[model samples]
Target: MSNYEKYLETQLQDLDFKEEYDNLEAEYQIIKAIIDARLELNLTQQELSAKTGIKQSNLSRIENGNCSPTVHTLSKIARGLDKQLVIKFV
Candidate 1:
């Protein structure tokens, strides 16, 4: 793992940090999934926004965790990227 990844793992050992991390895990995964998909297809936020008709600013907010994306918004983004958005319960 990278130094930053190792650092994060070490920091997460703290009880308080672990608690907060667990709480935000789902949201973090969602953001990471969207970003990973976009990067996998070599699309920029502006390009994806144009294709999805979602404002670039909103896309930025979603990626940065400044705002939550609704299912409808996620669907549009997925469709624009020719992918499916799957919600799993585990």
Candidate 2:
């Protein structure tokens, strides 16, 4: 494994680190999904911003996990991508 991966793996063995990581897992998943979907549609942040009427800087922050987007914001992004937003408890 790469050094970073190795270090992360070691960190994950710690209970505190593992708990904190788990807490952020959902946020990470959301960020990854947004990024992946955008790429799959071949849309840049700027293009998505124009389509969604959200500022490109805001979208960048959302994609980078630097900010939390509300359900309303997420819905706008989904519509911009010609997608439907579905949230569920699993």
Q: How does each model score on lDDT?
A: 0.87, 0.86
List where candidate 2 sits over 4 angstroms from the true fold: 1-19
> lDDT, candidate 2, residue 12?
89
Please report, as a residue range, the 10-residue window in candidate 2 with the lowest summed lDDT: 1-10
User: Please, what are the lDDT tens digits per residue for candidate 1 over residues 1-90?
Assistant: 544358668979999988987999898788878887888789999999989999999999998889989999999989988999899898
- Return the clash pairs for model 1, or none: none
Best by lDDT: 1
- 62 in model 2: Cα distance from truth in Å? 0.4
TM-score per candidate: 0.80, 0.78
Please give the lDDT score at residue 1 for candidate 1. Answer: 59
Give a tens-digit lDDT track for model 2, residues 1-90. 544347668988999989987999888677767877888799999999999999999999998779999999999999998889888889
Evaluated with TM-score, which candidate comes out highest? 1
